[model samples]
Target: MRAKIYGGCVSRDILNFDEAELIKLVSYNARSSLATLGSNNAAKNISKKHYDSLLNIESKFQRRMVESDFNNQILESAGKGDYDLLLIDFLVDRFHLAEIEGKLVTRSVEFLRSGIKPDRVVNTFSDQYLKLWKEGVDNLFNTVNNTVGLEAIRINKVYWTSVATNPQDSMMLNEKWDIEKNNAKLDAMYEYVENILPSSSIIEVDKNLLVADSDHKWGLSPFHFTDDYYRRMVKIFNA
Candidate 1:
C-alpha cells in the first residue's frame, strides 16, 4: 500500500550502510555556535565558493545550509527559548497540579512580544530551575546548543516551505521580509546566546529514529523530504 514514505527509494546501498556508517558524522563539532552567531556577520564564519578562494569547504551543501538566512531565524529562536515558566504555569493553573508541582518562581516574559530573546535564556532559566523545578534545563541547553535542536522543531521546514520558490503558493512569495528589522533583533540576541549548556550527546537519526524497511527517501534539503522521505518517516513512526 502507498504511504507518506516512499518504499521504492530504499535500495541495497542504504540497507547495507549498517550501524557505523550511518552514525559516523552525527557526532560533530560546535554546530550550536553557528546558531548563536547568525547575525549579519554570520557570512564570515562560513566558506564561500569552494576552491575559488583560500577557504575551500569540503561539504558545500552543509555550508550553504549554514549561510542561509532562513536557518538563522530557526536557530536564534531556539538559542533564546524561554518558555519554561509559561509551561510550568500551564501545568499548575490549567492542569491543577500545583500541590504536586511544589515550589515555583516568576520570571519576566516581557521579551515575548518585544522581538527580543532575553540574555542567556536557556542557561539562566535552567540555573533557576536548579532550586524550583524537578529537572534541569541541560537537555534544553543541549537542544539550542546543537543544530539537532533546531532540526527537531520541524517548524523550520514549514518556514522554508513558506519562503522557498513554490508554484503552489505565489502569495507567500510576494510577502517581502524586512531584512533590517530581523537583523536588528538577531544582533541584539547574539551576545546572550554565546554561553550555552555543554553535553556530549550523540545524534541517532539514521541508526535509530530515521530508517526505512524499503525506500529511497534520503532527503531533498536539510529539512524538507520527498515522497520517499515521508514514506520512510511513516515506517519510523510505526516502528
Candidate 2:
C-alpha cells in the first residue's frame, strides 16, 4: 500500500488534475515523520545524502511514507485548485507516538536486529507525545495549499486487533495498545481539527463500524480495512 502511494507520485502521470474531470487525493502517513523526517526512526530507510531532498518537495509528498503530489506538470490545477480531498490516518500517528515516547520502543527493524521483545519496551512517551500532537497536526494543516481546503477524517480502530504488531507487516514494534493514552490524544486531535476545519470537513467515524464479532474481518492489523469500508470512504470525498 505504501509503495502504491509512492508509485503514484514517483513519476508524473498518476492522475489528471482537471477539477471537472479529475478528482485528486493527497494522502500520507503522518506517524513516522513528515516531508523528510522519519517519525519512528524510519528515516534510516532513506539515505542521509538524499533524505532532505526527498522532503519539502515541490511535488507535495510525505514522511515515514510517501504520497501523491500536485505539480504543474504532474497535474495541472483543477482550475479551482488541484486536489479535491486530503485523508490522514490516526493509526500511524498513534503508532508513531508510541515509538517516540516509549523509552525502549524503536522501529521494528531496529528492534528485531537488537533481539529485543517488542512488548518489553516500556511505555513512557505519552506525556511527550501529547505535548507535540496538536502542534504537529496544526502545523501540518497549515502547510497545505489553502486553495485545497482539505477535508480531514479520523479512522476508528478495527476491533480485537493486537497492540504489538504492525497490521500491514508482522513487524513487532509495540506491546501495549495504550488505549487510555492513545484515545486521550485522539480526542485532543479531534477537538483541534474541529476548530480549524468546518464541521463538514471532518468525518466522525461510526463508533460501532468495526467492532469485533462473528462478522470480524480485520484481524490482519489495525490499518487494514474491508472493501465495503473502502468504498464507503470514497463516497465521503466530494470528487
Candidate 3:
C-alpha cells in the first residue's frame, strides 16, 4: 500500500527498513507540527534555493522536511488523494513553534540549524498553542475524511524511551530535551488524537520495548529504539 506520512521518524524509520516492501512511502513531511500545517509559508523573505545554500545542513531528507514546513505543504499534498494510507505521529509536536513573517512555523532542528531566527518562539504547552493545535487537528481530519476517508489513516502513539539497552551506554538524551516533560506532552497528544480517531486505527507499541539502542544507525537518542522495537512495529504493520 502507498502511504503518506506526516510527523517525525517514528513511522518512517520502520517502513524504511521493511525488507518485504509491505508499504511504500508516497509522501513524507517531517519536523512539522500540526500548528504549521494550515498556516502561511514561514520563509517569505528568502527563496527556497537561496535559503538552502545558507543552511549548514547536509541531509537531503532534512532539507526536504524544512521545505515542507516552510511551504506548509502537508495538507496540500494530503488532499490530493494519491495514497492509500496516511500515518501520523506527534513526535514533532514536542518542538516549539516560531513566528516568522507573522506566520507560525515549526521550529524544527533543521530550521534552527539553518540560521534564520524567528520573531518569536511559542511553547507547545501554552494555551494559545493548544487552541491552534486542536483547530489544526480538526482541519486535518476533515481534509482526510473528505478526500482519503478516515479508514485510510493510522496514528502511531509514539513516546521517547528513557532507558538504554546497554547498561554501559549513556541513558541520557540531548541536554536540551526533558524526557519526562516530552513524554507527558506526548501522553496528552495521544489522548487527544485517540479521542477523535478509532481505536482500531491506532498503532500501539509495547512499553517493554522502549529502550534506546546504543548501536543505532542514527546514534543514541530516546527515539532511536532497539531492534526488537522495530520488529514489533513491522509485525503490527503486517497484521
Using TM-score as the measure, which candidate wins? 3
Candidate 3 ranges beyond 4 A from true positions: 38-58, 174-176
| 197-224 per-residue lDDT for model 3 (tens digits) | 8898899887988888989888888888
Worst 10 residues of 1 by lDDT: 86-95
> Across residues 1-239, which tens digit of lDDT does each residue of candidate 2 receive?
11101111111122222233334444322223222122233212322333343354333423233221111111112113434444444444444321222222223222233232233332224555544555445444544444444442222222222232224232331243444555665566567667876766555445444322222243443334334344344444433
lDDT string for model 1 (1-239, tens) is: 11111001221222233333321111111111222222332223322232132123345543333233212332344444332110000111010011101211111221122232222332322333222222222333454546334223211011122222243332432354332333343333322322331121111134222222222244322123224434353343234
> How much is the lDDT of residue 91 in candidate 3?
81
Score candidate 1 by lDDT: 0.25
TM-score of 2: 0.48
Steric clashes per prediction: 10, 4, 0
- By TM-score, the better pick of 1 and 3 is 3
Q: Which residue pairs in model 2 clash with each other?
A: 19-78, 32-39, 33-39, 101-125
